[model samples]
Target chain A: MDEFELIRRYFAPLSGAHEDVVLGIGDDCALLAPPAGHELAVTSDTLIAGRHFPEESLPFDIGWKSLAVNLSDLAAMGARARWFTLALALPEADERWLAGFADGLKALADEAEVSLVGGDTTRGPLTITITALGVVPAGCALRRSGARVGDRVCVSGTLGDAALALERWRAGDRDRSDDALDLRARLDRPTPRLALGEALRGLAHAAIDLSDGLAADLSHLLRASGVGAHIYGARLPSSAAFDRLAPAAERTRLQLAGGDDYELCLCIPAARLSEVRRLAQQIGVALTDIGEIQAGSGLSVLGAQCEPLAFTELGYRHFQ
Target chain B: MDEFELIRRYFAPLSGAHEDVVLGIGDDCALLAPPAGHELAVTSDTLIAGRHFPEESLPFDIGWKSLAVNLSDLAAMGARARWFTLALALPEADERWLAGFADGLKALADEAEVSLVGGDTTRGPLTITITALGVVPAGCALRRSGARVGDRVCVSGTLGDAALALERWRAGDRDRSDDALDLRARLDRPTPRLALGEALRGLAHAAIDLSDGLAADLSHLLRASGVGAHIYGARLPSSAAFDRLAPAAERTRLQLAGGDDYELCLCIPAARLSEVRRLAQQIGVALTDIGEIQAGSGLSVLGAQCEPLAFTELGYRHFQ
Candidate 1:
């Protein structure tokens, strides 16, 4: 069978039926009707085999992370996940890998209540491109340009675990301690803060998903909003796994410059902090206050003593 | 500079502002509000370096055709093009290539009246994946499943020129005959039948864009409609260039199985033939009646002498 037929048999079934999806896999284009009065939030992310993840990463993990990162983008915008399309290129047609990949994708998609509407599969180097679509009420989209000076900077869940996991794996640490396993899971299947984002719609002024470390991503938010930020390093939440796995200095570096943590970093007004905290608690996601948006230019990272901290690198650079 | 910085300098300008687009390039996701009472049609197509096109193909043409194929899918659905996102992977950051590629992409996008929304670029083997979004009135979408037996099969413009062009190019024909250049143009920059498709909205029962060769693509339409088709070789439209450059037998073969034509293959009711023809004339697209849909299963190709034509290959198969 050809690659097209393989996709029809294995991957097409993963495009779950939805009322909004008028046409699905069998057509030249998939038809979808976004709910009335809602703006569609669209994002695309491409993951290459060796650069984005280790070449030896499991197919299931790769599939999960590919969708996870795209979903994280939608989550950052406080949009409700709706539909997505995938463009996957592979070296060869392997049935077992395809099945595992589809399973991993479907599991996360089902959790987010999103459906696969369309996709294209081709033969080439292994790469996956996913375009995810979501919906938000018109004019209610949370944007990076809305952060105001004096807003409390917050992040959901812990940081540094995914990068820590990669560091350990690269160092040939095969002992799989509980912390190691936990960190590895974070690297493989980072959770998107969809519910928390949806809950923070009006309360948060601006938000961004942490894909390129807190230092860099927050700087993006600050730049867009034309403000500055003061990040209290001591308050940047790190998982217990991170603390157990690395030294304090290394842990601080990971929290500041590590990538692949798909958590939402938000800027909320000081007046709404109590309500935002209540919403986070109701949603069952940890919301930690890590910094404050300030009136100035550039970002300032503070140590435990409220003194400026210096770092050689702020985030992962793709072409550096 | 990094890949992200490169995108900021080169591609950010290509993202023209559209009022419906609440947010464009520099955000976590692009926000768009589709006109009320319209359903969105989304399609994705990926072009790999050597697999989809020649390894030596101009970066500009690669960018144009990558978007063109996705637009063709939208055209086939009779949807009005709206927005698109690109996920581009490259072997290295070459500024000249990026500028030329952006120029080709922007040229087509301007003609289609679609705005670039969001995208991701990374380092890898060269590949371009484009997801185009369009809008159609609710429940007015043209679909492959709507064809019925006794429907007349029709096509827009010409067929087989692209495949014939590829054959000649492979045979080392470098001297540019008018026919060679015409066929080469057809292969490189085939126009999407957007106007004709939109005009056929209520007139055509079913439709599909020709990407895979006619024989294979027609089979897809038949399978979706639970019917069959008989394509008359004599009626299939061939360009003047195709007739001049290829042998009669070779022309017949290419017409049957050549891919990348990017024309609209549609099914219209026999009773509405005159009205459809008038609409085609008004739209300035040459619509040719090729055959008819039958009540049985499978497809049959008949020659000028009413004899069945046999073929060794059906169309381009990805994994063959």
Candidate 2:
């Protein structure tokens, strides 16, 4: 199969039936109509083979994760994903790979109700670039610069599981235990917290999705909002797999600074904590109160007895 | 510098001062307000290091052409350029390269009035993916499926210069003559026909940008419109450089099938011909009447004496 054939057979069918998508694949450009009173949220993310995922990763996982990461950005902005374009560069037109990729992409796209409207395919080292568009009411979208000094910082879902899985894989611990498989699944197929993010629009003062670990991502939010934060190390949420398999020291390190978790880190008013928790419960995700925004600069972590823990910045940095 | 610093220092300033951009870089997602009564046109294109351009090509050319191709798609749709997102993958953090790339990208973006709303940077083999969004009045966007029998075919600007430049470069004809430099410039900085495309919106029955050569790209428009066309080979536009340097047979071959011209190929009703020509002249582009659309499918090229030319599909195809 060639580029056009691959697109016609695998990608074209992924363009979902959405009323707002006036035109989709096979056109020079995809025409879209954004509803009145709504602004568009746009985000772009690229996942390169070997740099992003393992070189041996399944095509399905790469496809799922590529779109998932972009959607996570929309979730952080309290936006409803509407459409996305995939610019894919591959070494060859492998039919099986394309089939698996399209399947994985369609699975999440169906769940998110987002359409694949347009894309470009070319020959090169494997890379997937997805630009996702979402809609949010004007003046109601969450932003990283809205965190206030008195806001309580919260995160949806558990942290560090993806990082833990990656660590195990890198360490050559390929034992296929149920816990290991579960951890691997978390690393491969992260759930974009769209529902939780949209629900927190009026309740949360600021929001950001955690990709480069909690320490690094939260610091970005703090820097943008010009506020500091302190979290109790003992209060960090951990998955059952993480608690059972990871060492105590590694647990804290991974939770604080290991990357790849697609959870939302948000700053909500203290008075809205119960309501936020209730919404999290309704959404079926753990919304942990991890820290409190402070007036100073930088982040600090407190130990079990409230003594400040030594901090290290170990977030992932590209081209380092 | 790491990815964050690279983005902050080099890429962020490309975010133009556009009111529709409620939020740009430094956020998880860029917030954009599409104007009321207009629909958005979105397109994505990727240019890989060795595949799309010579591996030794300048970073400036790479950046400029990467965005140009995407805007070309919007131009084909007769949309006014607005905002874009870039996904870049680089092997290393090279400040010099980044600076040159940014300068090239900003030049065209500033002229086109398109803002860099958001982007992603990662470590990998050099790849650049850009997704551009534009707006056109609802139900007024030009499409490939609007051609009808007897519609006059027209094309803007010259063709074959870029392909000839590549041919010369590959044959090691690196003469520093003005013609050689001009051909090289065409290869590197093919102009996007934004003004001509926007002007052709109501005048043209169907339109497409000549990227994969007139033969292949026009075939696509014909397939979409379920029509056929016959163009006079002698009427195909050629730059002065091309006419002066290329041999007779090669000239016809290249003009008919060469790619990367970035010119618009439009099918206009015979009644609208003079108006489109006038608009093209106003936009400072050459509008040539090539032929007329036919009732059947596929394209046919007529030689100088009006005899049907034996056509060969030498147009660029990935993974061929």
Candidate 3:
């Protein structure tokens, strides 16, 4: 099919081709008439083969992960996903590859209620960049700088499973028939936590997504909020796969520094802990309190008496 | 400087630091509170090394062209350029490269009245993707399907200059000086014609930017408007470089098919021809009528006796 028709069948239907989007997929540019009295949350992510993912990763997973990662960023801000534009540069226009990729993209867009509005498809190395727009009530979106001292640090969903799955996948373990296979699939294709993020709006004082590992992402929130945090190693949620690798400290390290976690790291007032628990139940995601924002500088992991734990680096640096 | 510090100093200041931007550059997401009664226009473009440009292109030009190309899409839809988010995946965080790149981005952004709202920086291949947001008065944006049969087809500014510059740069043929060299610079850094787009809002029936050559981009408009057109090659506005090229037909071919001309292709009814000319003069740009939409399918190029012209290939195919 031609480019215009492809967008109409897959993208326009997801974007709804409705009044919310004044100009949808078929236009020269997408004219988005965002809902009145709401704020638009914008975020962009670029995924490159051999860099962001395995060079041999399936095209469908690539499409799913690229959009999923960007949606996670919006979720961190407590915004409801609305529309997205994709800029896909492929080495060649392989029909079978595109159909699979589009199927994966449509599946997530349909589930998230985000329309694939307008984008550019060019020839290049396999690269996909998605720009997602979400909406939140005026003056109510979550921010990284709102975390205050004495706030309990909470995270939605488990951590380190995706990283462990990546490690297992790299080791040539193709056992997808078991339960751990589901975890491996989740690593390949993440589910952006939009519902949980929306539910945490009034409950979360500060929020950030764990795309670059918990420690690195949490460091960003702490830095923006001008506070420090003390994470409890005993309380860090970890996958059994990671726990089997080394001692408890190393598993905690993985939970703290593993990239591609895609969980939400939020800070809520200590008094709001019960309410946070209730919201998590309503959203059907486990809420784990792993740390506390403190009136100091830098992040610290503690033993029973709150002494510092040691690690060579805080998290994965992409350059390294 | 680190990525965080660079963003705060260079980008945060450029985002206007206003209340409408609920979240600025430093957060996981940038929250934009769109003003009342206006629709947001969104478009994205990704420029990959050795694909969108030559491998040895300048970083400053890369930065300028990335945003300008997306802004051209906004202009095509008659959207007021508002803000943009950049997703940059680079091999390293070289301070000098970033300083020059940010300078070019800031320069163009300031001139277009577009702010740098938010983005993500990662270590990967040198890939630059920009998602631009614009605003159009409610129900006032020009679209690509508004053209009807018998409408006069017009184009703003001259064509083929960018392609000529790229050819010269590729061949190392730097024979000209002064104005010609400056004209070549225009190819590298295009003026998106935002003001001209806004001026044509009430006059032009349908419009699109001349991105993938005049013929290809106009073909898109024609396909969308469900009409055909006849155009004489001699009526097109061209540069003296066309005269320098051997064989007059070759010149005409390049003038028609050479891409990267960021001029606006506008369709106006016979009644609005004089008004189109007036707006072009007010905007200090040329508007030349070279064709008309007809009740037919497919584009036809007219010769002395309206004979069809043949081409070795159609204008660019992105995934070819």
Candidate 4:
């Protein structure tokens, strides 16, 4: 099928009628009315085949992960997901692949209550780029530069599960244990903490979604806020699977430097710690205290006795 | 350089402080406050190296055209440019190429008064995807489905110059004439008619930007509007270079089916023709009455005697 036919058959139905979306797909541009008294939280992300995921990855998972990553950015900003545009580059228009991909994308979009507003499809190397737009009450967006020296650093959900799954998959460790299967699922489909993020809007001082591991991503938050972080290595949260399967040193490595965890790393004021915990509990997501913002300008992970621990790797970088 | 370093060095400087931009790069998401009472016109476009442009094309031109094509979509919707996000996937981060690309992108962005808000940089095949968001007055977006019978089908500026340039360049015709150089320049930098599109806003019944040739793109507008058009094949505009160098038949072929024109195809009520012409004059963009919307469906290209002409190709289609 040609570009237009592919769009009409596979992509068009993905767009749903929404009150804010004045015009959706099949337009020169999607016309959307931003809710009054709201600021748009916009983020863009691209996933490339073989580079981002396994070459044999299911199209459904690719579609889910593409939009999920961008939504994670919105979540980090404490924005409510509203709309997204997909710019898809594929080697060819494979009907089966497109069908599965659309299904995967629509499933998450439906859950997020976000509409597929507009997009472009072209023929090239398989690359899926999604630009997600969300809305937050004006002046209420959680920024990375908002963290104070005394703020308590926290993260929602488990860390390094997705990266561990990727490592195992790459090593061809086909252990079909429940933990293995769960890790693979985590790698394939990350859950964006939209509800938890929105819940933390007023309470959290600073936030960032973990993509390039806690070390690198949190370092960014620290640099942006001009503060340091003293992370308690033992307090780093992990799934039961992670705890059971990973060796001690490997677990520490993955937890600190393994990337692709879609969990939100946040800094909350000391006074708001209880409120933030209650909120995360109400939202049904695990929130863990990982570190504290400090007055200095570097990151240090503390050992069991509060001594500095040496870290070998920070995180993944695109071009190193 | 790593992804974050590359962004900080090359892309961050592209972002200018704008009143509407609550937060720019360095955050999880860019915070933007859309103008009050204005609806956002959002569009996304992807340019894959060797697919969208010649692999050897200058990074400058690649960047310019990448954002320019997306702006063309916004222009077609009659929106004023505002903010855009760039999602770039490169095999490696070449400093010189990134600098040139940023320069090219900044040149056009500055002219359009749009700000670079945020983006993603990932390791992959060279691919650039931009999601541009513009704004138009509420209830005033020019849409593709608004055409009615008897509306004058108009197009801004010239067509086929870029396509002809590509044809000649592919043939390795190294002609040094001014026309040859102009054609090549056109291919490299097809200007998006933002001013003309904004001028045609309320006066035009329907609009579309020409990317896939006049024949195919206009057919899309026709299909969307549920109307047909009797296009004067000879009236398809051509640059001085095209008139001087292109053979008659080749000219017609290129004008009809040449993709990459970035010009606006508009449907204006016959009564508003004079105003549109005057406005085009004011905007310093050529406006040509190429056809008239008629009852029924499917586009028709007419000869000098008003007889229907047979055109073999419609336009370029990926995976065709």
Best by DockQ: 1
Q: Per-candidate TM-score, first chain only?
A: 0.97, 0.97, 0.92, 0.97
Tens-digit lDDT string for candidate 3 (B95-154): 778777787787898888777888777776788889999888888888999889989999
Give the range where candidate 2 chain A is weakest over 10 consecutive residues by summed lDDT. Answer: A311-320
Candidate 2 CAPRI grade: high
B1-320: candidate 1 lDDT, tens digit per residue? 68668878878877887788888998999999899999999999999887777777777787788889999999999999889999998888998899888988988888888898989999888899999999999988899888999999999999999898888777777758888889888888878888887888988999999987888888888998999889898898989988888886577778877899999999999999999999999988899999999999777888778787664444434312
C-alpha local distance difference test of each model = 0.88, 0.90, 0.80, 0.89
List, residue by residue over B118-137, the lDDT tens digit for candidate 2: 98999888889999999999
Model 4: per-residue Cα lDDT at residue B221:
87
Clashing pairs in 3: none
Q: Measured with DockQ on alpha carbons, how good is candidate 3?
A: 0.71
Tell me the DockQ of each model, to 2 decimals. 0.92, 0.88, 0.71, 0.86
How far residue A314's Cα lies from its native spot in candidate 1, in Å, is: 7.1
Alpha-carbon interface RMSD for all candidates, in angstroms: 0.5, 0.7, 1.3, 0.9
Task: Show the lowest summed lDDT stretch of 10 residues, model 3 chain B.
Answer: B311-320
Show model 1 residue runs off by greater than 4 Å: A313-320, B311-320
**Could you tell me how far off, in angstroms, the CA of residue A121 lies in candidate 1 after the best superposition?**
0.9
Cα lDDT tens digits, model 4, B162-223, are 99988887888879799998987788777888888788788999999999888888888888
lDDT of 2 at B250: 89
User: lDDT tens string, model 3, A188-285?
Assistant: 79878899889888878999999878878888888888899999877877655555543454466567777798888989999989988998898788
Instruction: Give a tens-digit lDDT track for model 4, residues A119-182.
Output: 8898888888999999999999999999999999999999879888999888888899999989
Question: A320 in model 1: Cα distance from truth in Å?
Answer: 12
